[model samples]
Target: MKVTVELSSLNKDDDKIFGNIYFEENEYAFPEKGWNDFVIIILNWWAKSILKLLKNISIEEELDFMDGPASVKVQYLKNNSFSLYFILNKEVVYSSEVDVELFTKAFLKELNSLIRNIKENRWESEEIYSLMENYKMLQKCFIP
Candidate 1:
């Protein structure tokens, strides 16, 4: 399965960022219509969760997109594999098995792109800075 993440439409004024996750044909978009989700909080949580997974410190992790009413629950399987359950409004929207290495690659790629976009747009904020710190930690510890 192909998994990828996209982040865009950073509204500095309202402190919201719009984004979507694509797992092959499955798509999960956040906030639906308004500026309700905080970009930094979501991204930081994701980065930290991924870090824990990489370190084999957590067998399961659940990421909740605050105010978006969406979440992703990741459960580790044997031999660098995981089960990903995408939830929307307390229901499972999609679920699939994913290779940990591939998922990490996709996540890191999108994260790099997000950092570049932030720099290019000059959209600096405290929240953004905190997220960057978390990203840095993730990068330092990531193996592949």
Candidate 2:
């Protein structure tokens, strides 16, 4: 499976993110208990870790998450009077904020850090991205 993230928004400071994960083989073929399940099961954990980083910066925020067939929203209120919203699911994932002044710098910094961590730890063990690569290659083989 291969997952790619795309960002779109009204401005460069606060934007929306969209993520799509493609599978090469049968959906049930994923090593993480087959393809019928989504990679989100693994990613959700990472999401929690990502939120922890903002613990000191944000407060009084509500994390409304729905582990259903729909989406999940994680909201964080920063000390600078800014709020960050992370809408994520198996098909789409994005982060944005309401306060420009508060989230502009912090949001970008946190996002960059999150991406870096994913890239670094992904190759260490049976990580989610590795499974995506396997799925992508497996699916590519069928293209011919």
Pairs with backbone N, CA or C atoms under 3 Å apart (clashes), candidate 2: 1-132, 1-135, 1-136, 24-139, 27-35, 28-35
- lDDT of each structure? 0.70, 0.34
Q: Write the per-residue lDDT of candidate 1 for residues 64-129, one digit (tens) a residue.
A: 776657787998888788788878888987787888877777777777787788888787777778
RMSD of each: 3.5, 17.8
Write model 2 residue lDDT over 1-144, tens digit each, in one string. Answer: 122222121111112212322212234211122112233333434334324434443343333332334332334444433333333344434343444333323333333443454455342334444434433433333355
Where does model 2 exceed 4 Å of error? 1-64, 68-98, 123-144
Query: Per-candidate TM vs. native?
Result: 0.77, 0.22
Best-fitting candidate, scored by TM-score? 1
TM for candidate 1 is: 0.77
Top lDDT hit: 1
User: Which residue pairs in model 1 clash with each other?
Assistant: none
